[model samples]
Target: MKITTLIENLKNDSQDLINESGLSLYIELDNKRILFDTGKTGSFITNAQKLGIHLEHVDAVVLSHGHHDHGGGLLPFFKVNSKAKVYMKRKAAGDYYFHILGFNKNIGIDKKVFEEYSNRIAYIDRFTEIMNEIYIITDIEEQDLTPRGNKYLFAKEGNKRVQDKFEHELMMVIKQQDGICVFTGCSHKGTPNMIRAARTIFPSLDIKAVIGGFHLMTIPMLKSFSASQEEIQAIAQMIVDENIQKVYTGHCTGVKAYKNLKHILGSKIEYIRTGSQIYV
Candidate 1:
């Protein structure tokens, strides 16, 4: 499998690529070209062009959640890719918001995009194999060590707003002959829980690598970490316990948190940027 970082919060040493506080990965596996996320805008499309990635030929699109940073490029993508079906959690269209400092900001995907590409969007509510060896796992029940940064995120339920349970979050698992590679958008459901969920579903397959943001930033306004050093250590220890071969994370994972994790995980963890390319 080959994966390219289409857009991310950071960039490589090259000045040719653009970076944003979002996540998107172009994945090629089993003769399939899959777009993991759309970043926060059409900038990912621009980067793709620079990287010589043909978005028009993409086979599928997977929105990690309802967050705009993940699905905001749906409109631009639909304009170019006419055949790929976009897959997302069934409840991903819910009214999500980021409430901080007594203010509420709408952070969900654009409703107009949903109405425009209703037919091409696939709303998944359960475990589904979208294609051969490619599966989407939605039922993440083990919630230990969920991101403390998620405290500010909420979803509208009827007339009242409640903390987001993140049922709308999903993980993509690509089962290869040796093991399985996991793709997460922001890991709002918690990285450890997502890994456990994948392991539970595919008990026989080894977890080769986990890619995407861990949502470790607690205060976005000040760019502060929500997870304490001990918490980060625990999360890293969990990864060690699971015996994951590698972890590629960035975006909302926060620099401080990444460094803390790096101090523990060492070479087992690596940061991915806008122009990063990985083969597994």
Candidate 2:
């Protein structure tokens, strides 16, 4: 299996988006093309075209959650591949804040986006295998022991305060010989918590790599907003313990936070920017 980021805000190359967040990718099982989330703009399509990647070749598309930064590109994707299976939580069709460093990005997928392709869509709220060696983590809860990372994420249904509990998100783990390469789209499920779930749900598999957004970077005003350094350290330690050899994270990872993460992970962490491609 080979995982790459076809579209993103930042990139290793000079052409990468500086601060803007964009497209993400998740290819699994050697041939299965699983696109996790679309970037915040139509550039995802443009980037795909630039890379000579055909949207029609994707086997499935999954919206990690309902943020425009992650789900917005679906509009262009829909226009190209109108018949692929799109897996997402049913509740993602509501307005939510893709909160970030001192800004609120509104993201919500309109029902019309999938109205024509409803027959090929699957809304998952539990653990399910979409294909051989690919599993989706759904409605994950916070860890009972550890207490770091973002604890404020929540969901609202109509007028009620919904416990985000990371329920609207989904994660894909691709089994590999050395271990597994995990793909997440803006891990609202808490980075550490997602890793733990990956271990529990797929105890037989080892996580070799992780590639996606870990919305750890919080509001710009650091005076009381943002995940603590202790939490970051703990998460970093967990990754090392799990033996994950490589990491490609960006988008919601906040430039500052990820910089710290890179230092901690050392040679094990590799940030994937826009137009970045890696053979895992």
Candidate 3:
């Protein structure tokens, strides 16, 4: 399997591609072309074209969560990949709000978009295989290492807003040659928790790699959403204990958090950026 980053927060040396606080990946595995999480805007489209990725031929598009940064490009993606089917958690359509300094901002995929693509989008409520060896995993019970500092996020239930339980969050597990590769969006449920869930489902396969956003990024200015140093350290240790061979994380995995992880995981942890490519 080969994967190429279509969009990310960093551009590395690719001056032509636009960068934003979003993520997108184009993956090719065994006669299947899959797109995992379209980024915030059309930038991913442009970047994909430049990277020689044909979005029009994508076999499937899997959304990891309901956040706009992860699913915002759905509109443009549909314009190109008419034959591709979209998959997401059944609860991903809930109204989501991101608490800012003093107010809450609705940061979810547009409802109108979902309505327009209702027939094309498949709402997943459980573990289901969309392709030969790729599965969409849902309802991850956070038995341990739950995500921290996410109290600010809220979801609308009835007429009231409550702390987001992240019921809409989902993950993808792909069967690789020697092991399994797990791809996540922001991991709002906690990276360790997600890993544990994947391990349970595929107990026989070694976790070759855990890739995508870790949600460990903390901007000093946005203190409410950032993970604590101790939490980051603990997450790193958990990954090591789990014996995950490679971790390609970036985007929401804050610079400091990633640096610390790199220190601990050494070459096992790699910073994924725009235009980056990986073969498994």
TM-score-best of 1 and 2: 1
TM-score of each: 0.97, 0.86, 0.95
Residues 111-198 of candidate 2: C-alpha lDDT, one tens digit per residue: 5666756776788878888888777778466763233234434456688644455456777777767787777777766778788888
TM-score of 1: 0.97
Candidate 3, 99-180: lDDT as tens digits: 7478878888988668998988999999999888899899688866665656667889999988999999999999877999
Each model's lDDT comes to: 0.90, 0.70, 0.85
Q: Write the per-residue lDDT of candidate 1 for residues 48-83, one digit (tens) a residue.
A: 999899999999999899999999999999999999
The alpha-carbon lDDT assigned to residue 62 of candidate 2 equals 77
**Candidate with more favorable, higher TM-score: 1 or 3:** 1
Ranking by lDDT: 1, 3, 2
Stretches off by above 4 angstroms in model 2 are 16-19, 26-29, 98-105, 144-154, 160-163, 220-225
The per-residue C-alpha lDDT of model 1 at residue 203 equals 91
lDDT of 1: 0.90
Residue 258 error, candidate 1, Å: 0.8
